[model samples]
Target: MLQRCKTLIVAIIALIFSQQALADTAWDSYKSRFLMPDGRIVDTGNKSVSHTEGQGFAMMMAVANDDRASFEKMWNWTRKTLQNPENGLFYWRYNPVEAQPITDKNNATDGDTFIAWALLKAGNKWQNPDYLKESDAIAKALVAHNVVRFAGLQVMLPGAKGFNLNSYVNLNPSYFIFPAWQDFADRSHLTVWRDLINDGQKLLGKMHFGNPQLPSDWVSLYSDGRTVPAKQWPARFSYDAIRVPLYVYWFNHNSPELQAYKTWWGRYPRDKTPAWVNVTTGDTASYMMDGGLLAVRDLVLQPANVAAPQITAQEDYYSASLKMLVALAAR
Candidate 1:
């Protein structure tokens, strides 16, 4: 009896260690695959280019995994390479192949939010005042530059430049970044962030307007009190819009705004759900939904007890990142 008990304990210990190993391996593999030595994160799906969004995602993930070294590396790279020191905002994109790596200096609001949120979290986790100060500065800059009162509610522009077209301003609903907004609201004591959240939820509720009734990737907020899909962008619920539900679910799983996504997605069989939908043309994507998207679908639709799917080597940067995020939220 004693010998048998000893063997069982050994087996249990091995299993626990194995499980921990697997968790570490997943994060380690993600860092190795997508994160460069210099801390830039490559968007594998987007021609291996680096973007502020990617860097922010990486920094957030690093914090989630409690990898302070990785977080610092990513932050350092971002500060050195992408930050417009004059304004404390980051440039949206960097193409290593180009003679001028940063061809555009526009600040993507969503990217700024993500980075600020990550910095705040890292500061709290590591007790670093510098990170917190930087985050606060970025938050203030966002409020000063990217946000505007349109149609009687505060709304975040997708970027600092080119979004305002005379009487109308272009917006991406997915860029709302609900959790980050909430954090900013609390940290900055700015009612605008709270107002933005409320307005964002209202915008999200109304943007779903098609046969299937889903939010478009881009929308226009007009001066004369109208909101519709942007004329310049395709009227589709594609890559950008897919993130809406994920953010909503993360911030508030019981949110009524999330129900629209759940209901619309429920119409299609899980395996047959397309990667995107053209709300204007009523056309679906040719390809099936990827693992990351499917993981998000399951997360939003299923009960919390159901375990999130594991990340695999086959997945790309975006998909793998989504899977990791879902796993983090699940915890």
Candidate 2:
């Protein structure tokens, strides 16, 4: 009887593992179709390239999946092709065909930083120093050259020389480079993490895009503490906004602020999935990949015993997120 019980337990464990393995492959395949040779995943059916957020989010998935080869190829392509000398930043728009930067004028500072962060993570995982060093260089460049002064907030400008500062100061910019700032906090022993959080919070507060739905993006800041609302160009609340909530929870835990943010999200039914929502209204908008990624993070990292629902929305596209969730859950 004892031997039979042990065999049953082992079989159950094997069954569960097999199911998870198959599920992971399905998700990986769904995302892999969008991936480009140079690591840029183009819009479906259209050859036009997208920005770093999706690319970064996908890379996060790669990290989650422990796909070292995929991670390496993407990171290498991003660094070699995207590095910009003029602003010491990473160019935002790239040509899909040749995988070359489209506009020297539009550098995506956040994407650059995020890629550097992913590379650093990969380096650390594999015990390689070169990737770490490369990450460090990009971090320095983002801080040194791409920052713009606006409305009393120090903001990341859109591109290097001659780019429009007035257009870049919105909330979306904060999300782009913040991951790198958070990642660097432990290594450099600097308050870059706190600084970014505080600065972003300050900007978030100022936007008065209140209600915790967070703006998709924002405009550049000026010398004085005033903002020019990019209402039309708002970054659109989606997965990016979830970072603010996640950040608050990570640092503040179950504090009122974190609860408030979570409650704000709770107002929406999980069944009514949309890509974007107005920060104030919570109305449904088209869905995007970031929304799915953010959902995974929120579900896995919710304060212990918190009553938030576990998101199982897009199982395949979000497989990387699922792996991450499992890892965190195990921890």
Candidate 3:
């Protein structure tokens, strides 16, 4: 009877492992393709460069997949390679082909927030105080360096520099990173995060442009609080603004901010949806959105149809990351 009971326990454990394996199919594919042995995630679509955003995205996915080992690998590499000793924030990109991989020392605020949020989450889930401690340090630096007041509205800049021109500021709508802000507010008990959430939503609500009413990829706000499509950029609702709705819906599904995205996306069928649009001139991408963008569109429009996500073998790093993010949001 003792042997039989032991055998039954072993069988149950095996069954549990098998079930978990079945559910982690997408993560497995993503890791096999993009994740290098050194824990750097490659941007296959962008000449195999690694960035803080990709590192944060993978770390978050590792936590979601319940893979602590993978998360540690990514965190270790990111901290070693990208982190700037002067500040807790990471440099934006690493080009392996360049003599100095870190060509840009400027920090991307979204990546910093996501990394902190992932660390906070991993620390909570795994009951490790070390991860939590590091997360706090990073979070403090992020709040100190990136979060700032522009035009009487508390807004986050695209990076640490060049974005704040004293009299005006450039904001990337995608960088608002609503879910991370919410998590920071809950965990750190910081009023600034809460304030950011409220103010960010309001600012984004006023950013829509053109007849279709879409936000541009990059927007500019003057000291007087007036907004326009950044003169320096192409003034299109392209890659950057594509993530705005994803973050917003993840933070609050019923957000009025999603209305513009929903309206614009609703005009096209799932397969025919354009990759981007010129919010000012009404021009649109001749090519359609990739699998990841489609996944976001589906989630934004039809929240109830939460099907399991799959990663195609040919899917690029960014698209796969987006699809995985949508799957997490769906859950």
TM-score of each: 0.92, 0.70, 0.93
Candidates sorted by lDDT, best first: 3, 1, 2
Which tens-of-lDDT digit does each residue in 1-331 have in candidate 3?
9999999999999987765675598899999999999999999999999999999999999999889999999999999999999987999899999999987899998888889989999999999999999999998998888889877788888788899888889899899998898888888898988889988988888898887687898999899988899999998988877788899889888988888888989999888999989988898889998788888899899988845667898899989999888887877
The candidate, 2 or 3, that scores higher on TM-score is: 3
Who wins the lDDT comparison?
3
Q: What is the lDDT for 208 in model 3?
A: 80
> Could you arrange the candidates by TM-score from highest to lowest?
3, 1, 2
Candidate 3 TM-score to native? 0.93
lDDT of 2 at 72: 71
| TM-score for predicted model 2 compared with the true structure | 0.70
Q: Residue 101 in candidate 3 has what lDDT?
A: 92
Query: Which regions of candidate 3 deviate over 4 angstroms?
Result: 1-23
Model 2 lDDT tens row, 1-331: 9999999999999987875675466446535555666676554423556666445556655765677777776666665666566555666656666645465446665577667677677778878899788777777776666655555555555444554445344435345344456677666666655566567656755554545434445543545665543555654555445454444443444434444445545665554445556665545566533434444445534444332223343433333333343333232
User: Lowest lDDT 10-mer window, candidate 3?
Assistant: 15-24
**How high is the lDDT of residue 220 in model 2?**
37
lDDT of each: 0.86, 0.55, 0.89
